[model samples]
Target: MTTPDKPLIMLVGMGDLSARVLTLLLGHDATSRVVLAGRDAETARRRGNLALFTAANLGRHADIRSVGLDLRNVAATAETLARVRPDIIFMGASLQSWRVITQLPKPVFDELDEAQLGPWLPMHLTLNHLLMRAVRDSGTGARVVNAAFPDAVGPVLDKVGLAPTVGIGNVANIVPALTHGAAHLLGAPVEEVELRLVAQHYFSHYVPRFGDAGEGAYHLDVRVAGAPAAVDHHRLFAQLDNRLKRLGGIDGQLLTASSAVRVLHGMAADSGVRAHTPAPGGLPGGYPVRIRRDGAELDLPEGLTVERAVRINEDCQRADGIERIDDDATVHFTERESAVMNRLLGYDCTSVKLGDCPHWADELARKYGEFAARFDT
Candidate 1:
């Protein structure tokens, strides 16, 4: 139950990312009441108990509970939302995990990697679409933080006025690398370094692997001790690629969970806080945002107008396999990505209509599963 003193937070998935976020929230003593909701009631209960036990051992206390929620059933989910009436909702559920692609053989994985993350949009978009509709129907004004492929998912949902308040991870995962690299370059403390970055998900992966933004368009401005500083972008990125150690697979989710905690705290604080996040106000990609009690808004760098920043991300979205999101929330895929999906899974989807997301998601999952099974041996 929510009270005036402490806010209620709802974690909508019992996956690794959500579990990590729950632990961090409890460890930070950020909230009093947290409801872990998912499809599997037993899993949710076990995860909730583990979180509670971990927090208790760490000398932290919170009201942790669990509930079974099938997001595909909008009415039921809405009923749950109306009953819980949380202050904030962090949605991490999806039809399929992004890591499913990694399960393929290395050669196959490399081939599909060229398609980028956009071809897998159906898996990430469907649940978020359902959840947002539930939120609207339930008449809850809870601020939503979507963890699904927000760089593209956020914009697609925004076409129908169902966009999340903001999104976590993605571009946010790049900020820390930039901050550390800049601090080392300037010989300054990390706390004294501030940066405003306008980017999308592509650069987050590309910069770390290739030591450059590649074809992705982005803007970065670094300030040391509150003053604009001149730093070498090439050198900074190279160091990030060469010197920084980034965990791969599930372990890397810690960076994303930390980003969500920061945004959650900012949203609850009266004075608000500034942080880098993806899909603020359902924009094309990520930007520095000012998160307040009410919501989040883009805090773009000086001289960078909203139009220019959006254009930059819009252009980069193509490199990520998304051609564009139509005004009606239909998502179009690049020719290469469409062909790749057809070749690999025999699941052809050049475009997807918002209303047909559930059908497409199911088909994609089934086809991909069969495809992966053939190579399992």
Candidate 2:
């Protein structure tokens, strides 16, 4: 429950990302109250207790609560939201984890990887759409930080005035890499370097793997000692590709969870924090943002207007396997992604209407499960 002195922070999913976020919150002693709500109450309680125990042993403690929540049931979720009246909600639920695709054989994984992250829109979109509606209906007015594929999901929800406050990870993950690389090239300390990056999910995923943006577009500005610096983008990325070594698979969630904690603290603080976030205010991609208690606003470069920044991300959508998202919330998949889904899973979804996301999500999950079963033996 919320109190006048301490704010209630709600974690809506019990997934790995949410667990990591919970642990970080406890370790940082960022919140006094936290509620872990998910589909399984027992699992949420277990995780919450373990987190509290770990934090207690480490000399940090919090009032942790857990409850079963079926986000698919909007009325129930809304009731819980109203009851808890949390100040900040971190939602990370999805029909299926993105890692599920990577579990396939290497050849099959590479084949699906060609489609990028767009073809699996339904799996990521439905729960968020439902949660937003529940948020609106509950009228809690809590700041929401979504951890799903916010690049596309955020914009689609924006069409209906249901976008979350801002998205975490994605572009944020790139900013740290760029900041460290720039500091190394400038022979400055990392703390003295400030980076403003505007990129989408595709570029974020691509640059780490291949060191370059491939065909995706982005805007990057670097400053050292509070003065603008002229660093070569090519050399910066080269350094990242050569020097930065990251753990693969679920191990990487630490970076993402850390990013989420940063955004959460920024939003909870009275003053604004200069940060990078994906899908702020339902934009096409990520941007340099100023996060405060009020909300997130674009803190773009001097020459970049919001319109131009959006256009850059809009053009790069195809790189993420999305052709476009219509004003009415209809999502058009790129030809490559559509063809790959059709051929591999026998699920022919070229476009998806926002209202039909749940059905599409179910169908896609079923087909993908059957397809993955073939390789089990």
Model 2 over residues 31-80: C-alpha lDDT tens digits?
A: 64789999999999999999999988988878999988999999999999
- How far off is residue 367 in model 1, in Å? 2.1
- lDDT of candidate 1 over 1-377, digit per residue (tens): 56644678899988899988898888655564789999998999999899898889988888988889999899999999999898899998988988778778889988877788888999999999999999999998888999999899899999999999899998889899999999999999999999999998988877887788888889998998889999999999898678985876788888999998888777755336888888988998899988876667788878999999999999888888899999999999999878888998898999999999889999999998888898977
RMSD of each: 1.4, 1.4
Off-target runs (Cα >4 Å) in candidate 1 are none
Task: State TM-scores per candidate.
Answer: 0.96, 0.97
Off by over 4 Å in 2: 1-5
